[model samples]
Target: METRLSLRYTGPAVDEGLMDVYQASANMIAFSEFMVTAVKATFGDAADAKANVAGFGKGSFITDLVFSVGGPAATIFASFTSDHLVTVLQEAFGLWKHLKGSPPTEVNQSGQSVSVTNNTGQIIQVQTDTLNLVFSEKGADSVGRFIKDALNQTGITGVEIASKGEPVAHVAQHEADYFVPVAKESPVSENVVTMALILVAPVFQDGNKWRFSDGTGTSSFSAAIEDQTFIARVNNGERFGKGDVLTVEMRIVQTRTSNKISVERVVLRVLEHREAAQQPSLV
Candidate 1:
């Protein structure tokens, strides 16, 4: 079974402490959603994917504030959920930390570097300095997942080439416009922001229709089957099949404020199960 998990930031009432804070919040939400989409692309189901300790479900899974105060500077807490949530989270955070510093410098090596004009009629010149692009290790995986998910969410499909063979494929590439950075500012009070995520995976048959458990009460399936398949792919590198149930979980976190509203940290939890029980076969 395959399922889709999504997150959307409705936008805050106030721009808040720093322009970056509001921006960071928006970016985080987008990034988190992107991560979920990536899991769906990789696992084909949210349930089959690994989840946080928190849990998973439908409706709005939100993290209003990880840490909040009346002031401009406050810590923020946030999280995301899906199958492979832990691994994805770890990678995302790692990348974030890695790229938190200054942007790298790039230079042109060819002689007679000349200025050129683009279709927009904007003049550009090549630099002679070495470029130093840095990516955050803290949220690397998460960010990658986010970008990956964003591409899949676009509804585009294709074949992915591999050394072993051709697998069902999808493509997601990042553009400069898609990149948003965390902002910096001092806080007025000790406010905090918190975030929570829910992963839901629906069960389905060959036709992509929802699947239900047999009346015999032996095998069971539910919304979480997708998540389970995700986790299975992460752990075993396999895809989910019919009659599987996905498990959903959540990850919550709170962090001390500094400048940005990025995820300070997160902890996960499992919520509910919609699958049936397994029974012995009748001879």
Candidate 2:
């Protein structure tokens, strides 16, 4: 079913009926992804959701659009009223806000319902199937981070979710930080293994990952070099260019709740560094 919703922004960002195209696009994209996550988490794994903009209006800056929730479980969404979605968003944001700055001292959850007790002993509870949307995150996702960044931008004050031209949910400027997700748990596992990587790009910075890839086209990733000796050699003018092969011990860490798999590539040791065959210059 298609639910008409308007994302209206108010403040200096939309000055005189104008908003930066890039900023507007970023916010829209982030919100769309957030909605997609919310839909699946709320309805079920089989439910898919997407947003389509119909037009942009500028009383305070609004993108009038439709959220198409479809898939095998789409019927469930049809029965979900606009208020239901608004409640989900509001509660999700509220949960994040509480978790980040002033985390709950204790959380009592019974399936989809949760009761949180803060440091001040204040207890707040929310019951919704979408509670897990914000409940299970070690850190804010790139989408959530981007949305928070957009909201905190200068002149961008507030956001309101509306249906039928009436506001049903509101996110105030002061609440912008609520969208910034915080890490909740540590990685599930960390394993070290020796792997051969071909240098794709080199970083000379103090703390930045260097890009590399295996011979196969399947994977390319950036990793932090932890071999002090090898790094010292590079600092002393060791000529390692792109396509150079390096065999090193790399650390792989996996976090389940956030579904994050990261390569720290401590590069414990560089067993070998083979120079790629040089191509003749056509000068």
Candidate 3:
């Protein structure tokens, strides 16, 4: 079990640079120290620089380390690396377990997805959270075969399997166009939408109505809530004040008597809530 982990800096702001030369050098040296310590922990200094090897490209901020192990020993080493990396990085990174004789052909990471080509030349797309795993065409068939074989070994066979069926159906049903379709109300109301914004005014209750501004150029909006859930969470032992950041799900209901203004109904579904000190997302 060989675990590989990495981090890279890439952004549109080239002027910002990856890191200062001095800081880059310092980070690389610190990471190299960690690699050496990891190797020593796995092999108890016997392997040293021989079987447990680590190298860094000249003037680069990356390290390529490899450990040769077999059978249960490999599994132990992998578990060690997994835990070690998390402890060292404080759970800010993740590792890939590389089985002997089957190293990945390619590895790429992005803001939303991580793509890896397994040794068998099949692609695996994994989300950062590791909850959604998508295997390529060949990869999916290979996994299905493995699962079928496992089921056979346990005297359970011929089971139906499907991945991504729900998402496919959901998209087809919602996004597909048809001549005659089922009549239904829109999931998103006529003027209802979600907003993530910085509050410019303190949230205060006047009877059943709450008034606040989202710091937008447009005029502020007021909402009336019957459900106590939204305000309960907003209060959070204290009232939400100005400058706090929030993601709100609201409904835009037309006013019967007014044409110029509409009521924004708080749905009580606080998608996100944070203190004023938290920075608003720029991306």
Provide TM-scores for the models: 0.19, 0.70, 0.26
Report how far off residue 250 is in candidate 1 (Å). 53
Give RMSD to native, each candidate: 23.1, 5.0, 22.0
Please give, for residues 128-231, the per-residue lDDT of candidate 3 as tens digits. 33311111222223322322222232222222111112110011111112111111112333465787756555544535555556666787666654446766
Tens digit of lDDT per residue, candidate 1, span 26-65?
4446544444443443233322222221222221122221
In model 3, the runs with Cα more than 4 Å from the true position are 1-189, 203-206, 234-236, 256-261, 278-283
Specify the highest-TM-score model's number.
2
Worst 10-residue stretch by lDDT in candidate 3?
Answer: 166-175
lDDT for position 64 in model 2? 35
Which consecutive 10 residues in model 2 have the weakest lDDT in total?
A: 59-68
Mind sharing the TM-score for model 1?
0.19
Residue 147 of model 2: what lDDT? 46
Q: Of 1 and 2, which scores higher on TM-score?
A: 2
